[model samples]
Target: MMKQLKTLLIAATLLFSTSQVIAQAKIAHVDTNEIMSKMPAMMEAQKQLDNLQKTYDKEFKTMVDEYQSKLEKYNREAETVTEQLNTERAKEVQDMEKRIQDYRQTAQKELNQKEEDLMKPLMDRAKAAIEKVGKAKGYQYVINSTGLLLADGPDLTTDVKKELGF
Candidate 1:
């Protein structure tokens, strides 16, 4: 009975030690916001997005100006024109307003799509760099510091930025 008790105690001690070693996970944190802000590719992507938005804004302004001028001309001619001509002008103005609305909607959709297309690759690159750094550095868990209330782990944002080559 004494020998049996010694064997059981030894087995329990071995199990506890193994479990303790396994529990010591290498945790790390990263601020993706910081990493992305420092990335050159992200900066270039943002510049391109801004330029695209400016182009869209210019085209939209032109359309609006044309619509306004046509409406003003129709209003001024309405007084001297025939009833049929006045009705036709009114229909034309309504059609122009509808077309403007449709164009604005389409432009918005296109801009959103363009932004998504431009951002996806940049975001994916950042994510890949973070993953690569975490694995290379033997981090079992990497948490984003952007949303963390308390982060006591070592920050890997700089490492990730380096891994991204910027």
Candidate 2:
């Protein structure tokens, strides 16, 4: 009976100690999206991406306009050209259409790559700042509040922003 009582007491003590340790753990939250949006580097990167997209748009428009002009010219000349010449012109137009599609696809891929390249460093910087703040503040766990339905812990977004000098 004494041995059973001792075992029960030890188990109860362990449970209470574990709860106390959990209660002492410090938790905080940060909105990473908020931090990234406010970052000047990210803003500049967005502007650059926009400008690149505009450039691509302008080039695509030029190509489309040229294709339309050629198509119109072919239509006008269709009645005068020989059967063989008409067939060749149609093939040329088809080839031009294919090239235009390939160019658009390539341009889209390049733009996506550029955006990823530009954002990677900024994201890394934000992560580093978050880690620094979490360690300095003695946070056992730092949760991202952006996706949380209920976040009542201390917000570390401002601290991370300050740490990044933004």
lDDT of 2 by residue, 1-166 (tens): 9999999999999999999998899989999999999999999999999999999999999999999999999999999999999999999899989989998999999999999999999999999999999999999889999899999889999999999998
Top candidate by TM-score: 2
Q: What does the lDDT read for residue 58 in candidate 2?
A: 98
lDDT against the true structure, per candidate, is 0.88, 0.95
lDDT of 1 at 43: 83
Task: Name the weakest run of 10 consecutive residues (lDDT summed) in model 1.
Answer: 36-45
Give per-residue lDDT, candidate 1, residue 103.
79
| Tens digits of lDDT, candidate 1, 7-61 | 9999999999988876798889999899888888778878988898888789888
Give the backbone clash total of model 2.
Answer: 0
Mind sharing the TM-score for model 2? 0.83
- Cα displacement (angstroms), candidate 2, residue 161, comes to 0.5
List of clashing residue pairs for candidate 2: none
